[model samples]
Target: MENKQRLIGIVLAILGASFWGLGGTVSDYLFRHQNVDINWYVTARLLVSGLILLFIFKLLNPKLTIFSIFHNIQSTIQLFIFSIFGMLLVQYSYMASINYGNAAVATLLQYIAPVYIIIWFVLRKKANFKLFDLIAMLLTISGTFLLLTNGSTHNLVVPSSSVIWGIISGLSLAFYTIYASRLLVKFPAILVVGWAMIISGLLMNFKAPIWQFSITQLNFANVSYLTFGIIFGTAMAFFFFIKSLNYLSAKETTLFGTIEPVMAIVASAFWLKVSFLPYQSLGILLIIILILTLSLKKEQER
Candidate 1:
């Protein structure tokens, strides 16, 4: 039974990561070709995906009340913080990065979240700065430098705005990972994620009013991409990832989640005809090694 469950988790993790990766590519297409507004896109994505997730949650666990997370004052505050600073910020920054750059670079940049997690732990005195941690940090810095500069200190391969947004996305993701884990101890993953998405979506509406925006390039392809991004990319991706946690350890799940950037890079290359310089490719390899090293270290420690 345990082996079967683990097998299911492995499949779910791969599918979830693949969806997210391909979703990034799809988002790139929309932003570059479909003339989709970033604000409107993020707003609609959150609202629609949140609604779909909540519907699934209700169907899967009808006895559990979704509102229970709001019963406590502290939990309510944490939820709001998670929604805005973590969920909303991650989503917006990621999309902005993709808009400014390509999906491959954006996804690779976001993969540096584990480095931030290491730094946070060190600062909190929760963990010591070990040799592996130092190596991971160096790898992250070097990889990012190569990726941004493409091995040239004199020039940047990507826009400065894209790098900034990508880094912010990584930071927000680190926060999301840490804080969401805390919340998950008290609430189900679906409930917390669903509410977070809805809360963030509602908050975003004040700034970008999805109802007021107009898409001039509305076509079948655009609509299909949008629908796929919302349904498969956002809703199903989150659902599958969360469900995988039921059968696998967090470390295992995250290790599999690295497939996200790989998929994004491949999809961007073929589907969008994006190209990476040789040095940038090396940087991507280093970053992947860094992630694997950190994940393996954590697993060994456990």
Candidate 2:
């Protein structure tokens, strides 16, 4: 029974990661080919996905009230902060990075969130500074330099805006990862995340209303990609990832989550015909190695 459960967890984790990675590629396609508006797309995606997640949670836990998070003043404040700074910022920055760069570069850059988390811990003195931590930092810096420069000091393979947005994506993700944990302990993941997304979506809609899209932007291909991103990529991906925690250890699930960036890189190259120079490829490999090293270190500590 345990073995079977583990197998199920592994499959769910892979599916979740695949959706996320491929979703980024889909967004890239829409941005580059369809010329979709990023603000409207992100707003609609968050709103729809959040509604779907909440609907599912309500079905599964009919007795639990979704509005309970707002019952407390402190939780309400934290939720608002997380909605804007953590969830909204991460989504907008990631999509902006993809718009300015290819999905592969954007995804890999976001993978540096773990490095940011480590730095945050060290700065706060919450974690002991170790030799491996320094090595990880160096590896991250070297890999980022190569990725941006592609082995040349004079030329940049990706735009400066892409790099900036990608770094913000990583920082926001680190913030989300740390802050979400506290909310998750008191409320269920679905409740907290769903509420966060809806709040963020509503906030974003103030800047670019989701209902104001032109009819020309509602073509079959654009609609299909947006649907896929909202349903499979956002809602189902979050669902599967959270479900996998029941059967697998957090470390094992995290290790499997690495498949996301790999899938993004592969899908971008094959589907989008995005290419990377040899030095950039090497840089990607180093970042992958860094992720594995950190995951292993965590496993060892456990």
Candidate 3:
């Protein structure tokens, strides 16, 4: 049974990662071809995805009240922070970065969150300030430099604004990881994430209501992109990833997640026909490996 479970877990992790990876490509497609509004898509994605996950939570754990997380004032506040600061920031910054630049570039920068996580641990005194952490940090810095410059200061590979938004996305991803840890301990992962999605969606909707937006053409191509962006990219990918956690450890899940940027880059090169700098790809690869090593060490210590 254990072996069977592990096998299932491995498959789930791969599928989850693959779906997530493909999601970036789909978003890139929409941005390039469909002229979909990034804010509107993010809002709709969050609303639909959150409601679906909430429904799933209700079905699986019928006894627990769905709104029970709000019973406590502290939990409610934390949930608000998670939704606005964490979810909203990460989703908006990431997509906006992609809009300004490309999905591959945005994703590679977001992977820098592990470096921020290491810094948090050291500052919090949760982990010893190891020499390896410094090395990992250096690798991340060097990787970013190489990716952006290819060792040349004269030319900027990505737009300055895109880099800023990508960094913000990375920082926001780190924030979500830390902020959500508390709520996740008290509630189901699906429920916590679901609520965050709903809250963020609602907050975004306040500024740009869904009803205000309309499709000018309403063609099949645009419709497919919108559906895939919400249904596959945002919702299903997250659901599969959370489900994999039931059988696998967080470290394993994250390690598998490295596939996302790869998928994004390859799809961008294929669909968008943008060639990757060999040095940039190499630098990103190094950063990914070091981040994995950092996570591995932490998991081992646990």
Candidate with best TM-score: 2
Ranking by lDDT: 1, 2, 3
- Candidate 3 TM-score, C-alpha based: 0.94
Instruction: Evaluate model 2: give its lDDT.
Output: 0.90
Residues 227-251, model 1: lDDT tens digits? 9988899999989998899889988
Expressed as tens digits, the lDDT of each residue in 1-302 for candidate 3 is 99899788878877777777777778877877777788887888789889988988899888888999999999999999999999999989998888888888898899888789879989989888778778888899888888877777798788888899999999999999888888988988889989999999999898777676676756888788778778778777888888888888878887777777777877888888867687877777776776577656654531
- Per-candidate Cα lDDT values, in order, are 0.91, 0.90, 0.83
Candidate 2 lands at a TM-score of 0.97
Better of 1 and 2 by TM-score: 2
Give me the runs in candidate 3 sitting further than 4 Å from their true place: 298-302
Task: Name every residue pair that clashes in candidate 3.
Answer: none
Clashing pairs in 2: none
Stretches > 4 Å off in candidate 2: 299-302
lDDT per residue (tens digit) for residues 176-264 in model 2: 99998879889999889999999999999998898988997678998899888878988899999988998998888888889889999
